[model samples]
Target: MSPQPHEKRQTLAHRLLEVRLQGRAAVLKGHHNTNYVLRIGLPLAVVLGVMPFVRFKYRVPLKTVEVVPRIWRSEVDVLAVVCRHLREVPRGFAVQGDRSLHRYRRGIVLSEQNPHGPVDENMLREFAAFFVRTAKVPVKELPAPPRDWPVDGESAKFLHWLIEFTERRVHLPNRERFGDLFDQVGIPADAMAAFKERHLSLVSRRFVLLHTDVHRANVVVRRKGITVIDWELAIYGDPLHDLATHIVRMGYSPTERRQMVDLWERAMQAADLGPLTAGLHDDLDTYVDFEYAQSVYPDVMRAALGLPTEAGDEHFRVAAERVWSAMDRARGPLELKSVKDVDQIMEALRKWHSMDAVSAETTVV
Candidate 1:
């Protein structure tokens, strides 16, 4: 007979307690995708709580179950399953295929969680390789898109609306608020307008299965391998969106970021996909720009989550400054000298110390 609700609850409680008690110094750490480090006597089992956007949990008995989930809403489940699958493979062969699989799973999960966090560069490269490989797999043999999904037009419209809604509330400051900085840094009104237009245009492209969010926090590094957690935003859209999200969230230096692009190009080549085509590059660029813009959301969300107002304000100011700096760099050479000249035009945004100083030193031509 099936267990009663009360019995099931009791069983769950007992299992969790047992795992906690038996586990040694295991702490749950993750802002988005919660996880538990389980020490089963000798072997360590990292039980990940996947799905940052939804509520669900799973405990796999073995390390080689199916990676894809039975339900559509359970991307975390699929990720956990994939991690377990990679872990079970023997060492030699596993080193190659399993490593790629593990990184791919972890990258997807991390992308779903907070984007700004520490990441293992090597693992990310491996995952990038795997992403290109999997995407190139014959479409006919791939799994079907989710049921009743909106077409690209509807999806693009929905995302555009979200961007607009978020933009309207730009006045609000949060832990990572940066809109104010954007306005101060001379990001021309035209540039912002063009960015929005480009985003809208790109969203209408052919959709592929994409992990809409790729960030650092959702990925976990263990002795065995990396594990990816969340998958709620998995959708049909441009694959480049996933790559761009990963690149932006990794927070690599400009040089490192360029290297990542090169790595992606290499992976594409290895997968027998043609050289980095212009169309593909443009798609990737569009996604990267959008990801950079959306990066402000985290600080905003952090403030919403009750971080101190001062801290949130600082974050917002800094992010805005960074955006402005990037925009200025994109424009022509810098030209401003003396504090008087700088202060007369752009307010002395204390948060942007370097830019402010530079502006003060240069004379506008």
Candidate 2:
């Protein structure tokens, strides 16, 4: 038999308490993701990791690479592989664990989160230089690229992944809802096709191991400088994807986004990696489109859960506004036939609130 609901809460609370045992301050709920992160020191925090592969554990913690991979980790810990080679990490952390614990995995120690906001262009440029240089750091020999990513041309491989991910992963699971989302936004469902037609040539230009998940939240601001964290999503794809992900996820204003691209290009050029920044003139939008497009599902799911109730009208409005942004950006890829205004989208979210409680009721554009 399974544990009672309260029993489950107790278990989670117990785990959180264990996570906070070393903290100098309160254990704070992480800004995003399920992990409960604790402020261990002035510029230090440790993320209690959720298991990576298994999806439905009621958002419960699962086994994860809590240590610096170099200190201790499995072969698949590519993040650690990079940590082993790179120096400009968030801060140094060694693995800490004990035998008595049941569920408290060693935490992913990081410098404090990037003051919970976007980094400036100068910082972004510094990060770009550090990023590519780290990529250039010659490992004794780069291990075989991910199996999903064969040792093939970067452009073709990621294009294949993009379409496959959207169609199979995004469209398949939430077909009706995703289709409705597209219809509501007046976008073509064949957005993936558009991505290929437009951006394919650009990604083909360069091949470098990329810290694909570099965004503001993952970047921690320190007194000295910024430290990039969250290396798990790192992929060996077009370097532009890194820039695209950073632009979108950091919530960089349009001006800053453009500056980010320019700064990145200049940084790469200075490093003599000019070819790496190629195709930004036209192809960057393709990757940005893919980033926004792919995010529709996850964004909706988050909005559904976090939207406010009757007493929380203001919060709900904020959540609705965010959903509106996601839908608006993803309109084309989602293949909407009609554009739903923000008010309509807000109402839809209110209607969907009941469904949010049903953890397994998964479907969204």
Candidate 3:
């Protein structure tokens, strides 16, 4: 039997992505996916041969916590919805098996140009415009939300669901492996509960499509405008959540963050999305708190997991500082009575590394 068209596309994509291929191919590695980029030329009959440059992305298998529903099962559905409405988003042609191909956007990542730098007024306005455009997309056009997704426009329920997801998926799943380390670093099991209780006053706002992960690295700056890539983490939720994540992940200074919020409010108002910004000033911090609270688990766990097998004291020190910083930021939200000192965190990392090494040796034998 002949291979299916989808199968052929997958095969060709894999072939073009091979490291041994003789061409100008670049492998872009990200936390969740590994992308292989190359330009090809051929007859119109063949699949994707006419494109200037194509990116073949395969999801990397890793033990990760699920904070939001990834359209990984069929990214094409969401991509269709987003690209149809927003030209700045890269269009995904197809998702076959584990591989998905996208038209490569030729530009420098915003992070490369300005890492954790302040955005100028013009760029800030553009960023706000993108958010406004995304927020205006009708939910009917989006793929069905996950079964546990909160009802549309239910901001309070959405926040509660997020807390539940963090507790159920992020914390419980990894408790067996990292529970002790979590305790050593001052993260108690009741942390999420306390956070949820403190943040119950979230003002209701109409939910909308949100690019949940809008960090600098995910944004490509072209001469025409900014193209936001990596829509895998996109979700339909309170718009403020997206803004909060962007502010935190973009590493904006205090003044820049305030300016960005003002710009976002103005843009939304101009687009007649005033309702979406209702109680934004009052509730934005709650969303920011949630971002901090939920991130601590992954930040600490990834730090520990990222240590090299033969890591020395310096590695442990770096990992400890990373974990400590996450804890410090989360203290207000999680109501942590005290944060673990750097030396304490370093000792805990050293122990975890030793145990991890022993486990690896056992499996090897």
Candidate 4:
């Protein structure tokens, strides 16, 4: 039988250790998981993308098992396009170990000399060119989504599918525990109001394959151009949603974020695919909210695992600040109800420590 939940977490943790013990790799922590980089290696530099699985109260529910394989398959599909169509990005070499489920892309790891932040003008322009090229790739040329994968890629239906996916993942798995979080924080029980389809109009838009999780760590600087890594979260959806996730997830300052936005608009228009830009100004916020909503469960549960029981309140305070910031950014756009202001969230976090800790278990790496 497969290992139990806690055992799975330990196994993943051990897998990380195994790579680290290899003595040639440097540990680079991504937003959600920790990846190992051996940039200097020859034919391929392996990035073992293992991290703590989420700590839901139960096993990954049968309902959610579909997300696992579907996402993996999507990653495989999107990577094929990047390899075949986009020279501006990295080539995802197939690996033997990845045949099991979770795998990593092996390539040159961009270092401080070549980094993901500090916005490069040329790099941004090239990224725009890459978008034009990606859009031009014929539909038949791109790989298809798996059988059970949601087929709707239009703005409206895709948004609905994404919102529902986040909701079920966040609320259903650990209903009472997550509810207690809301109750303690003073968020309305109906925190999903923002996700319901309404005034949003997505006409003039068609879906394109998106690097949905475009953050600094996942993107690496290269001599030829910029190379994006970590394809597991890749999805087929509104291209603006890709931009939305990129801006929020990447720690760009307000000024930098604005700069990137201006760059994207100019680039897409220049590429002659300007119609995809429709509804971007008004609807991008909704996608940002969805990202935050989708992220809270994993963030909270991960924070719980490292409470520093013997260390002190300092760690707790730090984690609370992070979680509060998540709620702060997300709640307004999410129309998250019953949220107990920041002070309340801090208080709830305090009470939470008195109870048993959130366990480490099978997670999405």
TM-scores of the candidates are 0.51, 0.67, 0.92, 0.72
**Residue 59 in model 1: shift from native, Å?**
10
lDDT of 4 by residue, 1-365 (tens): 97666445445544544453476544555443344443322112223232332110100112221221134443545666766776555433333333212233344444454554576667666556656666665556557665545454567667766666656665566655455764565444555544564424454477777767666566656566666766666666678778877777666677776777777878888878788878777777667666776666656655654566653667767777777776676666666654455555566776776554433222222
What lDDT does each candidate get?
0.44, 0.55, 0.81, 0.57
Most accurate candidate by TM-score? 3
Candidate 3 on 97-147: residue-level lDDT in tens? Answer: 555667778789988998866788888888999999899788898888888
In the range 1-365, model 1's lDDT, one tens digit per residue, is 99776445445444543554563533444443233333232211222222222211322222321211222344433344333334421111111111101122222344444355454568657667556644553443334555644454354553454355345433233213344444444433333345567566543444445555455665655455554444544555456666776776667667667777777777766766643333666666655665555443443233222323244445445544544444333442122221122332124244444443445568463
How much is the lDDT of residue 50 in candidate 1? 24
Scored against the true structure, residue 165 in model 4 reaches a CA lDDT of 66
Global Cα lDDT for candidate 2: 0.55
* Candidate 2 deviation (Cα RMSD): 9.4
lDDT of 2 at 192: 62
Cα shift from native, residue 353, model 1 (Å):
24
> What's model 2's TM-score?
0.67
